[model samples]
Target chain A: MKTILIVIFFLYSQVQSVEPDEILADQELENVARIIGKELRCLVCQNEDIENSNADIARDLRILVRNMLSEGKTKDEIISYIHSRYGDFVLFNPPVRFDTSLLWVLPVIFLMLLCYTFFRKKH
Target chain B: MKYFFLLIIMSSFGFMFYKGLKIDPSIVPSNLIDEETPNFQLKKVENYPLFDSKDLLKKEIKIVNFFATWCGPCKIEHPQLMELSSSFRIYGIAKKDNPQNITKWLKSYGNPFDKIGLDNDGISSIEWGVYGLPETFLINKDNKILYKHIGPIMKNDLEKINAFLK
Candidate 1:
């Protein structure tokens, strides 16, 4: 009974916030929209992506993504259009730019320093 | 030498954490600053004059405000807008709100907008990059977006708004 309940809970959690009305008619386009939505951050929720967020702005963004896809816009074009308006904060995977380069560089530098210290101590 | 490397790493992380603490995560900086205002055409609310992108190009400083009848902050900021209207041309976009509620709300609180637009579908708000209600944008004479205020314009903000206008 516990295993069954766990399975049900997992199934329920998989249900996305995308409303039926927001779904695209074309299956291929809908898949593409889902992929894009998962990458775009919901500005209102901050942490949750537009695909999973229940915020009104997330819904609006999901619809906008679908509309753009149906209008023949490529994923990059759609993402960039929203990015241009909302800026780097709205992108979950932020582009490596002058301002953002530190986020990518700091982790590798920390790792190298840790390895150097570990090996130096052993030697 | 080992301690020197450790100190550098620890201080760098400490510096980043200190800088992060100073920033309020809720305040997302406006990306549209210094950029041309996005193009949009919206219907007039009630009998007010229509507003569009072209109107922003006029050689005068203006304000674009995204508001909704259902939003609490929008009500709080309404008086500031009213005070601003005496000197500035303020354009309002009613986001996802019906005309009836807007008319009634404006009547009770007073309509401060020089021209009000009905953004019933909310596309205009998206174009303007409005994530929340009561977002105000200051537009310069060159039609560039000068500054953006994310929430209700309190009395203190009036001074800042005036400074931007100047």
Candidate 2:
């Protein structure tokens, strides 16, 4: 039991301490967690961010964020934590790369098509 | 003209989405719907016997509220709860709080609960699936939880609850 405790404690410390190499990983991931947390609305809370909410579930998620930070997890993994639980509604800034590509490009596409159509008519 | 049509559709979509956000997302369908009332006992502050959910069984609807003295939204939702007292049986679960503070808090505002139970440890709250303060549970005649509202009840919610009562 003592050996088990020592091993667990060792892992816990290893997980918590950011090595020099892990520093780059930590800062990058921590920044992402903070930004995503700002955007994702707390599901049970009325008008509160996941970071600011005092709800127990929010606290759990906050702990998850910090633990992931210590373990050297990335931005995508952090967003995925909230995404799996609460859905996209939690995200303040929706990811616009692929699934939401249309949302990002439709305006530019429409403008370009309009300009093209106008030029064609003149021709 | 085409851009104008696009603009109109997009704006309406945005408006509708924002309105939907305003609609309380707490009532989103959960599997826990229609579950049995979680076991809890609280010392009724009116100096009565210890009130438990099992004791409240009757052929009428009941409301269970979880509030704390420190919760600001609880204060805001107090009046709406008071209004519901006439229509249905409402019990208060003071989560992780002091009985004296709760009694004093209610006195300043006014007690809406028929039996306010002191949930001092909040262990009972976990069984009830309480995630935060100002939450409410609507139970049917059979003591089955029909709906759970996560935040403070507002005037519009009271109207909706009234409709359900009817």
Per-model tally of clashing residue pairs = 0, 2
Q: Residue-wise lDDT of candidate 2 within B20-65, one digit each (tens)?
A: 7888666433334677776666666656345686655777788888
Q: Which stretches of candidate 2 lie above 4 Å from their native place?
A: A1-123, B1-30, B43-49
Candidate 1 lDDT, A1-123, residue by residue in tens: 999999999988765899999999899999999999989998988798999999888998898899889889999999999999899999999999899999999999999988987998898
Per-model TM-score, in order, reads 0.96, 0.52
Q: What CA root-mean-square deviation does each model show from the true structure? A: 1.8, 12.0
Recovered native contacts in candidate 1, as a fraction? 0.55
lDDT of 2 at B95: 74
Worst 10 residues of 1 chain B by lDDT: B43-52
What candidate 2 keeps of the native contacts, as a fraction, is: 0.13
For model 2, residues A16-122, the per-residue Cα lDDT tens digits are 22223323345766666666567666667756887667666555555556666778777677677556434555666667778878667767866876786698789
> In model 2, what is the error at residue A31, expressed in angstroms?
29
